[model samples]
Target: MDGTPLILTSAERTRAARLLARFTDSYENSLTRRPIAPDEDRETLAKLLAEPFPEEGLGVDAFFADVVDRIVPYTTTIAHPRFLAYVQGPPNGIGPYAEAIAAVLNQNCNLWQISPAANVIERSIMDWLTGLFRLGPHSGGLLTSGGSGATKDAITAAIADRRTDFRERGLQENHAPLVLYTSDEAHRSVVKAAALLGIGLHNVRTIPTDDRFQLRVDLLMHAIAEDRAAGKEPFCVVATAGTVTTGSIDPIGPIADLCAKEDLWLHVDGAYGALFILADSARDALLPLSRADSITLDPHKLLYAPLEAGALLVKDMAKLRAAFAFSSTSSYLTAIDDAHLLDYMDHGPQLSRSFKALKVWAALRTFGVGAFRTVTERCLSLAARLGEHIADAPGLELMNPVTLTAVCLHMPGRNAEAHAELLTRLHEEGTAMLGPARVHEQACVRACVTNHRTTEADIDLLAERLIALAKR
Candidate 1:
């Protein structure tokens, strides 16, 4: 009773741990039966939103009860087996435990001296990822908040690589406007990154895609030449390994060749598709990823790590340091010279970084690499199976090639509104949660097999429901 409320007694800590274990067990068991979308009670939610914080503290038991009764029922069950919507899914089994451990330790991973173990763990994770891409001896990277942050940082480095005086003169003082090229199918992150980094939207060329939704390398070459003729400095080309809408992979090999010929920095956005390299079926298509100057990856997607874990891998470590490292005049943050250890603060934009790498490291270590490979291969197979079912079904058309784990389908007679209606019905009826997408201006339904919990039965059930809906 003498201790502050913030510090719980040993007996209270034991009780809290027991409660957490029980809640986790119950939730995991209920995931399959739970509705994919929440049935929101608007009145209750509005009241909760307007509620003010009390001066008196609620006991841990009452707080736990509130979470179980109020919060849990109103949250979307992304872990549902049939919850096939976007490039997100439930975290791996080890993720939550690792997250809890990281939270308890609360280590600031900015500098090696401050958190030696965390620094080493992050370095190890980066080394493993770089090895996956076969990035050379000089290659290294750092964890980011997500794919967007990684892509933004990659573009920043690309600018530094192209403009020697960029650090001093900045974009406003530059003579020629630097340009970036990416396929129309590339994630919006590329364009967003350009806009954020002072590269105007006009400077970012959206190259057309081929019949298969892959980037047309011929058009890309032509665009680069046209920019050069127009007195614009073409500096970077972003290639997509996994597109968001259809999971179409851009032609990386030819794009790499083009980049090499033009001396342009190549950054591959592999946030969704790159990790599919672990699958034998996808290895050949993504083998050319090693040729990229920099690559962005999201461990949360395929690696089954918890949210907010992304990374940027660069072939030359010195370039990444050059892009971000700033000499701080603060006496408290003296640079340490340890060859084996890295000060993460000098490698990225953030100085106060969290232990985001811990969950990723734990997942890889606990489940082993082969487990992830198996899950990825399974997802690919599931997508292909779903595509086949859609093609064979009456009135259903396969909109895009099942290149990876995203299957795009369309009803012959239905428009965008019909597809939207079907998606809404599926969620409301608890059949399955699918997303609506556009393929070449035609509306389609998209199911991404990013969840490891999903099975063949889940796919068949979803397909059956969709076919019934379309027929009606």
Candidate 2:
């Protein structure tokens, strides 16, 4: 702690509460009318880069003013009703309060002793996830920065399972180069994870997908057999529960079976699509995810917890612990795990973690799981509504089957540049912020209905506008 006191007085604290309420009310009120993607503020950016800390403190009032005047205007409103550009979720009503409380508590959620309540909160969330996926007994996981980090850690666990001496030998021993397999449409993070773990990109096989954009199980088996013939040690298969581009789900059951036969660790990167299992419409398609050795999820996406909350669940908790556990002898650093609680530091790479689970838990408790189930199901319905419009419209093509909440559409003769122009027009007109997409190497546009605030009318508006643009 610093020698100079930074504590607020009772009067200041009361004023701070008033300021927060005013800001939230003002911001929320302006959201519907303001543009989703604000234009660049180069002047503000330059000032921010050049400015240094002041010798005198800028009190809470000035800080709030700066946020309201300078920061909020430039930031992209990710919570906007039409923010379907990426797989992002808006914050739930209770999450911001939970986040505030978590910050006030300042829990270093890495150990049980220091953050007993946090440990239980995180464990409880993971328990619900494990049971939801039906990963069987002795399954557990931890929250990471997001889906990318979770994927990286999942691969680390896979490598450790491949070689018992991985932690000790560090891949220096005499052994064939490890191979990782994934569909071409799998998230780029999987490739990055393999490369970072010293699994050469050459050994990472990009298996082809079927017509539905699902990984072709027959081709995967062929690739594994070819790798085996070449004396390559195939270690893991990364499958997608919901692929990013088209929301296509790979045949999880088939991929899991192949992994089982080949003795490869099966990891489902369910970052985009897995949580949809909460919705009845999506549950049957996602149920096969349970067979995987490990699964990645993002509560920040479907759960609508604040940003930067991703989780990785493994079939066996012991394997996960073995992969990341460190034996410490220092009295200050020593910790133990029990049925009631466990050290989160032993689950993943980071030692200093925030209390992300509180937001997730609080939101679940506040709104109830049934509420999110409705939101997800509604999102799926809205996407389908868009898909129907595209299919029925003239010169507009439904590029992919509306598998989840992503609807990819194309113009009959529009080139990549034309599609780019259309997206720019949408952004400029403040109609909606949609992302550009490609299907079969042909450019198109994709609208992902990940926001709970998005409605059937919003989808129809976008669809009608696209149809109008395609006419040009």
Using Cα atoms with residue i matched to residue i, what is each candidate's TM-score against the true structure? Answer: 0.98, 0.98
Candidate 1, TM-score vs. the true structure? 0.98
Name the weakest run of 10 consecutive residues (lDDT summed) in model 2. Answer: 1-10
| TM-score, predicted candidate 2 vs. hidden true structure | 0.98
Q: Give candidate 1 regions above 4 Å deviation.
A: 1-3
The lDDT for every candidate, in the order shown, is 0.92, 0.91
- Per-residue lDDT over 29-107 for candidate 1, one digit per residue giving the tens place of the 0 to 100 score: 9898888999789998998899998898877787789889989889999899898999997899999999999999999
Query: Which residue pairs come into collision in candidate 1?
Result: none
lDDT, candidate 2, 1-472, per-residue tens = 7565688878988998899989888877887788899759898889978899999888889989988887888889988898889999689888888989998999999889999999999999999999999999889999999999999999999999889999989876799989999999999999999888898798899999988999999999999999899998999999999999999999999888888888999999999999999999999999999999999999999999998899999999999888999987768878865779989888899989999999999989999999999999999999999999999999988989999988888887778999999999999899999999889888989999999999778888888888888898
| Residue 223, model 1, lDDT | 93
- Evaluated at residue 433, the lDDT of candidate 1 is 90
Please state the error at residue 198 of candidate 1 in Å. Answer: 0.5
Give candidate 2 regions above 4 Å deviation.
1-3
